[model samples]
Target chain A: MNQNYSTVAQRSSSVLATNKVLRNTYLLLSLTLLFSGLTAGLSMFLNMPPMTYLISVISGMVIAMFVLPRFANSTAGIGIVFLITGLLGFGLGPMLTMYASLPNGGNIITLSLGGTGVIFMGLSAYALATRKDFSFLGGFLMVGFLLVLIAALANIFLQIPAMSLAISSVVILIMSGFILYDTSRIIHGGETNYVLATIGLYMTIFNIFISLLQILGIMGNDD
Target chain B: MDWMQIASALALGMFLIILFPAALQMMKNSPKAAPSDWKAVIVPMIIIVLFIMLLIKLV
Candidate 1:
């Protein structure tokens, strides 16, 4: 009986720890987004070379993403969190330059944020209410992602604006499915590592936001 | 290559990396245990190689 009690205590403590990590990840992500936005805004205001800056930042991100996860053991995870967020900020540079400079830039940014919020709320609510295991979604999402990737690359050469819109829509859907699967994983005790969970969630949100921004730019009236 | 192009490529690379390992592990029926041993690393490595080749062609 005593052993069982101790085991329960241990399990509870772990759950608490996971929750703490989740909270911290979210706090950090918010701050990182703010920092990235400021950096992009400042660069655009200064008329800096956005492309070169973005490339250098993204190159570092690619390296970190590959190397950091393998060593996400202690402060390593925190360091990775900052690195990935910084890269994402850099990724936003070009778009920020374009959108912020335009007369209707604010609208595009607003629409993108709204779309992201809607996706997060809708998918998160569904995951919480249904209680159905969404583990199967992982596979379907990957297949969908591959399809989008091929389509996106094809459009680059084909120069089809319509195809780009279609791909963006599909990418948004796939990322939403990922959000569901990832959130379910955490709530169901499937993902014990908070840093890994944050990484997964961050990717989903990042993809969704990017797609949303693209779609809004293409579809919105900029008068 | 353009920044937009590079960004897209990077995103794809990250997706492939996460997908390969997680999918292989999911294929196994073991609930708590990850399905792949070191033996499974070869498959993802091959996929990454193919992905890099494709990315090179695109760029």
Candidate 2:
């Protein structure tokens, strides 16, 4: 009887802890997204020229890979996450402006945003509801991510429009996969740090939105 | 399609072919939680399809 009571107590406490992590992750994710949006808006308002892709990508990687992990356990982690996201948002200003200048650019942007929202919400909801352990995706996701990165960098130099479109399409799928994997990780207690989880989710959403916009832009030009 | 288009399609197809099997295997092997109502999953998928269609129409 005593063993049964202790077991029940342990299970309840674990559930509570999982719930807390989920709540905190979502709360932080929302705030970071809003913060990123504000910065993006500010960049647009200022009409800032787009930072060079090499510089922006390199700096962003440094912050995410090095700075984030180093400071993820401290109060400073929140600030670093904001900085990384805000910089990314700021970098998007020029691209947004370029798109807005195009005919039907507004519609394209709106559609991309809508698509991204639907994908993220749907995939995340499925993961949370099913509570499937997606940690198995870790290796495959990493390999796929690296391949996409290499392809993207090559396309940057090759300047092949078709390849660019293909990369965008592939990235859209990968990012969607990431949304599922990351959310499942959070729910299954594979990821305990809400800050890091929030960053992961935020980056996935950002990439999906951008990839959709790129695809729309390419197709629009063809039309 | 042009050569570039053909190449692009091939690349995308290859990646998807490799990825799909691995993902399915992972899903099969992973320990699943208590099954939730299928409705929850189906509803979101429908929404996603509709949303994609909307984007295609816009493009």
- Candidate closest to the true structure, highest DockQ: 2
Fraction of true interface contacts that also occur in model 1: 0.03
lDDT of 2 by residue, B1-59 (tens): 44544444454454455556655665566554433533443455466556665677767
C-alpha TM-score for every candidate: 0.73, 0.81
- Score candidate 2 by lDDT: 0.75
* Local error of candidate 1 at residue B13 (angstroms): 6.8
Per-residue alpha-carbon lDDT of candidate 1 for residues A35-61, written as tens digits (9 for 90 to 100): 656665665666666564556455645
Off by over 4 Å in 1: A1-14, A50-57, A129-131, B1-59
DockQ of 1: 0.06
Per-residue alpha-carbon lDDT of candidate 1 for residues B1-59, written as tens digits (9 for 90 to 100): 56676676666566566666665655453233244432232343344335323322322
True contacts recovered per prediction: 0.03, 0.14
